[model samples]
Target: MTKTYQIQSYFNFLKRSTNQHGVHSPFVYDLVTKCFYDKKKYPAYQNIKAYRQHLLSNTTTLEITDLGSGSQVFKTTKRSISKMASVAGSNYNDAKLLYRLTHYLQCDSILELGTSLGIATQALALGRPKAALTTIEGCPNISAAAKASFKKFDLKYIDVVTNDFSEAINGLKTNHYDLVYFDGNHQKEATLQYFETLLPTITNDTVFIFDDIYWSKDMTAAWNIIKQHPKVTVTIDTYKFGFVFFRQEQAKEHFTIRL
Candidate 1:
């Protein structure tokens, strides 16, 4: 509980620590401005917002079954979809930020480790129309509901997998992920394992986003390992996410700029 409180405080501090102006690298600057700061409205963002709104409105509950490291927030076996949406789901700001990143990167292939109600998946899909996003959900029921929502939106190139993250990542033949979102396990060991497992899948342009970097001390240790890895050239600590990049051209630098 103390660790959780400390992490929350760090997050509160980070919410005021990083932003777009402090970045000087042309590439990073453009990314922060166009991706993080741009407020120009995209019609697709509205659809994703509506989907989230629907999730918030619905009060239906489901018998949630856990898979892939389980959840820290959910203490009981049964949970409401709307409660989960409002509690566990990514908030609007995070969704919009992801949307902007996908739009800026023009990423075609994306991998999402966790697909809770498909909120982030919808955001990514709406962010880049041409991107083919493969999101994994441990629970079949949740995946089913999310799949139905995707169908309702007529979203193409979005695949939902219901299986262990390890098995799914192992079965992957192609290693062409432009952006990988790690929102599954918050534990240090699992985080490191997933990072190592996905290491070979990364390209020079690959961008990996790890959620809840400060969730626990162990997670922070894992983040340190990820940042110090030889192949990792740059990292950005945006509090909610630790963005790792493997670009050969860029110098090794970590930015904790205020977002």
Candidate 2:
């Protein structure tokens, strides 16, 4: 992690980012008030916690094949499931946020670029039980492990595709997706490539989430370019994840919110 730089950037983000009180846009205000700040616990949270505990308790190791920007915490390809669950997988808070976003938006057809250990995938699957989720993973071993976890949890709606991000995106039968989560490649070129490839797939209500926008300067640049795209109507930057919206009814706006 770029600890020193990120800390500085976070301080800057704090200076610019606002709370719900500062928002004037009705749609954004409603989103922040209703969905982002909702405190009611849903039934799917139990399964999310249980699956996380299951991964944390497993001590099995697998050889990793990283095709994207390599891990920041890991120096070796050999890693244990527990370590990956702790360090590489999505944290509980972000997983819950994703669940809330999926459920709130009523996303029916979802696509995830990365499926590391199936932690986030499980949240998405449980968020909308009837939705069809297709998650792509570059590593065969990791994808297999995620598949096992999905089966163990009886999360039948998720389809784990073992392939590189580009191949998987190109092979998709339809470009339309209700929600798209990008966590596969961290490089600027790859990130922009995937964004452009999926640009046509986005409808007026489509929501795209980019993970780790502050992971690198290049990624931050990629996020900037994405926000500037003519089709993008609104964007919300929460430091860790950046959300893009293509609502035709919305005025073009960008927000940095304290989450």
Candidate 3:
């Protein structure tokens, strides 16, 4: 059986959308055109896409012990890495969006909360070769697998931290991050905590992307709170994800864009 009616509506809404045409801000408009619309054939994209394919084909099993909010697709504690990759990993669209977001920002420093199979992490790294990517994963085995795959892809700037997301984030000294991707914990409390904790680190150009924004009503509530923050100038809701911008030059506005 399926869950979360908001997720259903969210997916449905995402199905009907175009590129950022009416995005009035010059910065966002250029980002949409140059980054989102960029069709340049990068060879690195093939490697990232193939990494997902390899995960989908893998039959070897790894005990999946979740540390954060548990998986919605898995009811049992034990699961195969292949099955987890097939069912629990970020979908192709999200991965591509991650790439676009990173590419748009041209972020020199990135903090990723989850490194599931390194799909999104690779996307972020490949989008910006100069970026220093620090990704946190709770599972050592999963993180090892991801690190090996990153090597295979020749992505060298990634620093995979195998630890609890909250602890790692708290211990971090480098507070300046051009972008932060929140995908480790889907719970409302954890999401809000991370948002508030990282708020002081953001600059006027910082962009924060939250995954599974409509996973539950609680997540929707969290997303609402994030959008209402005083420093948050603009928000774009794409059902599955919510993007927050801290640009001081822009007026506070929200757009439910179909992506």
**lDDT (tens digit, per residue) of candidate 1 on 12-56:** 757657677677677777777777778888787788789998888
In lDDT terms, which candidate is top? 2
Q: Give the candidate order by descending lDDT.
A: 2, 1, 3
Per-residue accuracy of model 2 over 159-248 as CA lDDT, tens digit each: 889999998898774668999999989999999999998887888889999999998888999999999999999999999999999999
CA displacement after TM-score superposition, residue 149 of candidate 2 (Å): 0.5
Highest TM-score: give the candidate number: 2
Model 3 ranges off by over 4 Å: 1-4, 11-22, 37-41
TM per candidate comes to: 0.93, 0.98, 0.90
Q: What's the lDDT for residue 232 in model 3?
A: 96
What is candidate 3's lDDT per residue for 1-259, written digit by digit as tens?
Answer: 2275775766676675445776777776676677656777666667667988978887766666588888877887766767887788887766776777777677989999999888889888877887999999998888988888888878899999999888888886458899999998988999999888888778889899998887777888899999999999998777777889999989997776655
lDDT of prediction 1: 0.84
Arrange candidates by TM-score, highest first: which order? 2, 1, 3
Off by over 4 Å in 2: none
Question: How far off is residue 118 in model 1, in Å?
Answer: 0.3
Candidate 3: global Cα-lDDT? 0.82
lDDT for every model? 0.84, 0.91, 0.82
Supply candidate 2's per-residue lDDT for 179. Answer: 95
